[model samples]
Target: MTTEHLDGNALAGPLGEIFAVDVTTCTGRCASCGLTTPVASLHVYGPEPGLVARCPGCDEVVLRLVRAPGAAWLDLRGTVCLRVNLPD
Candidate 1:
Protein backbone atom coordinates (compact mmCIF):
# COMPACT_ATOMS: atom_id res chain seq x y z
CA MET A 1 0.00 0.00 0.00
CA THR A 2 1.09 3.54 -0.60
CA THR A 3 0.22 6.81 1.12
CA GLU A 4 0.15 10.19 -0.50
CA HIS A 5 0.89 13.38 1.34
CA LEU A 6 0.24 16.89 0.11
CA ASP A 7 1.35 20.36 1.15
CA GLY A 8 -0.59 23.45 2.10
CA ASN A 9 -1.06 24.43 -1.53
CA ALA A 10 -3.67 21.71 -1.71
CA LEU A 11 -5.74 23.84 0.62
CA ALA A 12 -5.98 26.73 -1.83
CA GLY A 13 -8.83 25.36 -3.86
CA PRO A 14 -10.92 24.20 -0.94
CA LEU A 15 -10.32 27.43 0.96
CA GLY A 16 -11.11 29.50 -2.11
CA GLU A 17 -14.46 27.76 -2.34
CA ILE A 18 -15.21 28.72 1.24
CA PHE A 19 -13.80 32.22 1.25
CA ALA A 20 -14.54 34.84 -1.36
CA VAL A 21 -10.85 35.66 -1.52
CA ASP A 22 -7.70 33.57 -1.83
CA VAL A 23 -6.51 32.44 1.57
CA THR A 24 -3.32 30.81 0.38
CA THR A 25 -1.72 34.22 0.10
CA CYS A 26 -2.86 35.37 3.46
CA THR A 27 -0.35 35.64 6.33
CA GLY A 28 -1.07 33.90 9.57
CA ARG A 29 0.79 34.43 12.84
CA CYS A 30 1.37 31.28 14.80
CA ALA A 31 0.34 31.70 18.39
CA SER A 32 2.71 29.03 19.62
CA CYS A 33 5.91 30.11 17.92
CA GLY A 34 5.22 33.70 16.94
CA LEU A 35 6.07 33.00 13.35
CA THR A 36 4.25 34.66 10.52
CA THR A 37 4.07 33.23 7.05
CA PRO A 38 1.75 32.73 4.13
CA VAL A 39 -1.12 30.45 4.93
CA ALA A 40 -0.03 28.33 1.98
CA SER A 41 3.18 27.54 3.86
CA LEU A 42 1.43 25.74 6.66
CA HIS A 43 1.57 21.96 6.85
CA VAL A 44 -1.72 20.30 5.99
CA TYR A 45 -3.15 16.90 6.78
CA GLY A 46 -6.24 14.74 6.63
CA PRO A 47 -9.81 14.77 5.38
CA GLU A 48 -11.15 12.56 8.12
CA PRO A 49 -12.97 14.58 10.76
CA GLY A 50 -11.61 17.73 9.18
CA LEU A 51 -8.69 19.31 7.39
CA VAL A 52 -5.92 20.36 9.77
CA ALA A 53 -3.40 23.09 9.12
CA ARG A 54 -0.35 23.28 11.35
CA CYS A 55 2.37 25.83 11.86
CA PRO A 56 5.59 24.87 10.15
CA GLY A 57 7.63 26.38 12.96
CA CYS A 58 6.26 24.61 16.00
CA ASP A 59 3.87 22.08 14.53
CA GLU A 60 0.99 23.63 16.38
CA VAL A 61 -2.42 23.27 14.85
CA VAL A 62 -3.22 26.67 13.40
CA LEU A 63 -6.45 25.92 11.68
CA ARG A 64 -9.07 23.24 11.14
CA LEU A 65 -11.82 23.18 8.58
CA VAL A 66 -14.76 20.85 8.39
CA ARG A 67 -17.30 21.03 5.62
CA ALA A 68 -20.61 19.33 6.08
CA PRO A 69 -23.55 18.96 3.71
CA GLY A 70 -25.07 22.24 4.82
CA ALA A 71 -22.58 23.66 7.27
CA ALA A 72 -18.90 24.40 7.69
CA TRP A 73 -16.69 24.91 10.72
CA LEU A 74 -13.38 26.72 10.74
CA ASP A 75 -11.18 26.91 13.83
CA LEU A 76 -8.18 29.21 14.16
CA ARG A 77 -7.33 29.17 17.81
CA GLY A 78 -3.66 28.35 17.29
CA THR A 79 -3.22 31.44 15.20
CA VAL A 80 -2.89 34.79 16.84
CA CYS A 81 -4.08 36.64 13.80
CA LEU A 82 -4.53 36.28 10.07
CA ARG A 83 -3.41 39.14 7.87
CA VAL A 84 -5.22 39.10 4.58
CA ASN A 85 -4.84 41.50 1.71
CA LEU A 86 -8.19 42.91 0.80
CA PRO A 87 -8.44 44.87 -2.41
CA ASP A 88 -10.48 47.97 -2.53
Candidate 2:
Protein backbone atom coordinates (compact mmCIF):
# COMPACT_ATOMS: atom_id res chain seq x y z
CA MET A 1 0.00 0.00 0.00
CA THR A 2 1.16 3.56 -0.69
CA THR A 3 0.78 6.26 1.98
CA GLU A 4 1.69 9.88 2.72
CA HIS A 5 2.53 11.60 5.99
CA LEU A 6 2.14 15.25 7.02
CA ASP A 7 3.76 17.26 9.79
CA GLY A 8 1.21 18.95 12.07
CA ASN A 9 3.55 21.90 12.72
CA ALA A 10 3.70 22.72 9.01
CA LEU A 11 0.67 24.97 9.44
CA ALA A 12 1.91 26.87 12.48
CA GLY A 13 2.19 30.63 12.18
CA PRO A 14 5.60 32.27 12.09
CA LEU A 15 4.53 34.86 14.67
CA GLY A 16 3.43 33.16 17.85
CA GLU A 17 2.07 35.16 20.77
CA ILE A 18 4.90 36.36 23.02
CA PHE A 19 3.96 36.32 26.68
CA ALA A 20 4.87 39.89 27.40
CA VAL A 21 3.55 43.33 28.19
CA ASP A 22 3.14 45.86 25.42
CA VAL A 23 5.13 48.95 26.35
CA THR A 24 2.46 51.15 24.81
CA THR A 25 -0.03 49.56 27.19
CA CYS A 26 2.08 49.66 30.36
CA THR A 27 1.43 52.43 32.90
CA GLY A 28 3.32 52.44 36.15
CA ARG A 29 3.60 54.50 39.31
CA CYS A 30 6.81 55.87 40.75
CA ALA A 31 7.83 54.42 44.06
CA SER A 32 9.87 57.47 45.00
CA CYS A 33 7.30 60.02 43.90
CA GLY A 34 3.51 60.01 43.83
CA LEU A 35 3.20 60.03 40.09
CA THR A 36 1.65 57.76 37.49
CA THR A 37 3.94 57.42 34.52
CA PRO A 38 3.74 55.38 31.36
CA VAL A 39 6.62 53.00 30.76
CA ALA A 40 9.12 54.83 28.57
CA SER A 41 9.69 51.70 26.45
CA LEU A 42 9.14 47.97 26.20
CA HIS A 43 12.76 47.25 27.08
CA VAL A 44 11.88 48.07 30.68
CA TYR A 45 10.00 44.81 31.18
CA GLY A 46 12.12 41.68 31.08
CA PRO A 47 11.68 38.15 32.43
CA GLU A 48 11.11 38.84 36.17
CA PRO A 49 14.30 40.89 36.43
CA GLY A 50 15.19 44.50 36.99
CA LEU A 51 12.69 46.95 38.46
CA VAL A 52 9.91 49.03 37.03
CA ALA A 53 7.26 51.05 38.81
CA ARG A 54 3.47 50.16 39.51
CA CYS A 55 0.13 51.34 38.15
CA PRO A 56 0.16 55.14 38.26
CA GLY A 57 -3.51 55.29 39.16
CA CYS A 58 -2.42 54.30 42.65
CA ASP A 59 0.86 55.90 43.77
CA GLU A 60 0.84 53.94 47.02
CA VAL A 61 1.96 50.94 45.02
CA VAL A 62 4.87 50.46 42.65
CA LEU A 63 5.22 48.90 39.22
CA ARG A 64 5.69 45.47 40.75
CA LEU A 65 2.44 43.55 41.06
CA VAL A 66 1.16 40.01 41.26
CA ARG A 67 0.25 38.30 38.03
CA ALA A 68 -3.26 37.12 37.46
CA PRO A 69 -4.08 33.44 37.09
CA GLY A 70 -4.32 32.30 33.52
CA ALA A 71 -7.30 30.63 31.98
CA ALA A 72 -7.21 26.82 32.14
CA TRP A 73 -7.31 24.99 28.82
CA LEU A 74 -8.28 21.41 28.18
CA ASP A 75 -7.23 19.77 24.97
CA LEU A 76 -10.04 17.62 23.67
CA ARG A 77 -9.08 16.34 20.27
CA GLY A 78 -11.99 15.70 17.87
CA THR A 79 -14.36 17.58 20.17
CA VAL A 80 -17.47 19.03 18.59
CA CYS A 81 -18.52 21.79 20.99
CA LEU A 82 -17.51 24.38 23.62
CA ARG A 83 -17.88 24.45 27.40
CA VAL A 84 -16.83 26.81 30.19
CA ASN A 85 -17.07 26.65 33.97
CA LEU A 86 -16.49 29.74 36.12
CA PRO A 87 -16.28 29.77 39.87
CA ASP A 88 -18.70 31.71 42.02
Candidate 3:
Protein backbone atom coordinates (compact mmCIF):
# COMPACT_ATOMS: atom_id res chain seq x y z
CA MET A 1 0.00 0.00 0.00
CA THR A 2 1.21 3.50 0.84
CA THR A 3 4.53 3.88 2.65
CA GLU A 4 4.04 7.58 3.22
CA HIS A 5 2.98 6.94 6.82
CA LEU A 6 5.77 7.69 9.29
CA ASP A 7 7.15 4.80 11.28
CA GLY A 8 8.39 6.25 14.57
CA ASN A 9 7.93 10.01 14.45
CA ALA A 10 4.21 9.36 14.08
CA LEU A 11 3.93 8.92 17.83
CA ALA A 12 5.59 12.28 18.31
CA GLY A 13 3.16 14.10 16.07
CA PRO A 14 -0.41 14.98 17.02
CA LEU A 15 -1.01 11.35 17.92
CA GLY A 16 1.24 11.63 20.96
CA GLU A 17 -1.46 13.67 22.62
CA ILE A 18 -4.24 11.16 21.85
CA PHE A 19 -6.28 9.56 24.65
CA ALA A 20 -6.87 5.86 24.03
CA VAL A 21 -8.61 3.22 21.97
CA ASP A 22 -11.76 1.30 22.98
CA VAL A 23 -10.97 -1.92 21.15
CA THR A 24 -8.35 -3.79 19.12
CA THR A 25 -9.29 -6.05 16.22
CA CYS A 26 -7.77 -7.45 13.01
CA THR A 27 -9.37 -6.37 9.74
CA GLY A 28 -7.22 -8.45 7.26
CA ARG A 29 -6.49 -5.70 4.77
CA CYS A 30 -3.14 -3.93 4.97
CA ALA A 31 -4.35 -0.94 2.98
CA SER A 32 -7.68 -0.76 4.75
CA CYS A 33 -6.48 -1.61 8.25
CA GLY A 34 -6.12 1.02 10.92
CA LEU A 35 -3.00 1.21 13.07
CA THR A 36 -5.21 1.60 16.13
CA THR A 37 -5.74 -2.15 16.55
CA PRO A 38 -2.23 -3.25 17.53
CA VAL A 39 -1.72 0.11 19.16
CA ALA A 40 -4.73 -0.53 21.38
CA SER A 41 -3.26 -3.85 22.51
CA LEU A 42 0.07 -2.23 23.40
CA HIS A 43 1.67 -5.14 21.58
CA VAL A 44 4.48 -2.86 20.49
CA TYR A 45 7.43 -2.01 22.68
CA GLY A 46 9.39 1.19 22.34
CA PRO A 47 11.43 3.29 24.76
CA GLU A 48 11.64 6.27 22.45
CA PRO A 49 8.72 8.63 22.16
CA GLY A 50 9.13 8.09 18.44
CA LEU A 51 8.61 4.38 18.11
CA VAL A 52 6.86 2.17 15.59
CA ALA A 53 4.56 -0.76 16.30
CA ARG A 54 4.05 -3.44 13.73
CA CYS A 55 0.61 -4.46 12.59
CA PRO A 56 -0.28 -8.00 13.70
CA GLY A 57 -1.87 -8.85 10.35
CA CYS A 58 0.53 -7.59 7.72
CA ASP A 59 3.65 -7.92 9.85
CA GLU A 60 4.52 -4.45 8.55
CA VAL A 61 4.34 -1.59 10.99
CA VAL A 62 1.20 0.49 10.85
CA LEU A 63 2.66 3.21 13.08
CA ARG A 64 1.77 3.88 16.74
CA LEU A 65 0.17 6.59 18.85
CA VAL A 66 1.40 7.25 22.37
CA ARG A 67 -0.93 9.75 24.05
CA ALA A 68 -4.05 9.22 21.87
CA PRO A 69 -5.02 12.77 20.99
CA GLY A 70 -8.41 14.42 21.30
CA ALA A 71 -7.97 16.01 17.89
CA ALA A 72 -6.21 13.98 15.27
CA TRP A 73 -5.33 14.96 11.76
CA LEU A 74 -4.02 12.48 9.21
CA ASP A 75 -1.77 13.40 6.31
CA LEU A 76 -0.97 10.90 3.57
CA ARG A 77 2.36 12.70 2.94
CA GLY A 78 1.55 13.75 -0.65
CA THR A 79 -2.00 12.48 -0.99
CA VAL A 80 -5.26 13.28 0.70
CA CYS A 81 -5.47 14.55 4.27
CA LEU A 82 -8.06 14.34 7.02
CA ARG A 83 -8.67 15.89 10.41
CA VAL A 84 -10.77 13.74 12.76
CA ASN A 85 -12.28 14.46 16.16
CA LEU A 86 -11.13 11.82 18.56
CA PRO A 87 -13.33 10.39 21.29
CA ASP A 88 -12.99 11.63 24.82
What are the candidates' C-alpha RMSDs?
2.6, 19.5, 9.2
Residues 1-88, model 2: lDDT tens digits: 1123122121111101222333333343344453444443212221133222223334232322223245322221222221222347
lDDT of each: 0.85, 0.28, 0.37
TM-score-sorted candidate list, best first: 1, 3, 2
lDDT of 1 by residue, 12-74 (tens): 877887898889899999999999999988888887777888888888889998888978889
Clashes of each: 0, 4, 6
Deviation (Å) of 19 in candidate 2: 3.8
Top-scoring candidate (lDDT): 1
TM match of model 1 to true structure: 0.88
For residues 1-88, write the lDDT of model 3, one tens digit per residue. Answer: 3333433333433443443422232221233344333233322445344344555555554444343335444322221222334458
TM-score of each: 0.88, 0.24, 0.33
Candidate 2: 10-residue stretch with minimal lDDT: 7-16
Better of 1 and 3 by lDDT: 1
For residue 27, model 1's alpha carbon misses the true position, in angstroms, by 0.3
Q: If ranked by lDDT, best first, what sequence of candidates would result?
A: 1, 3, 2
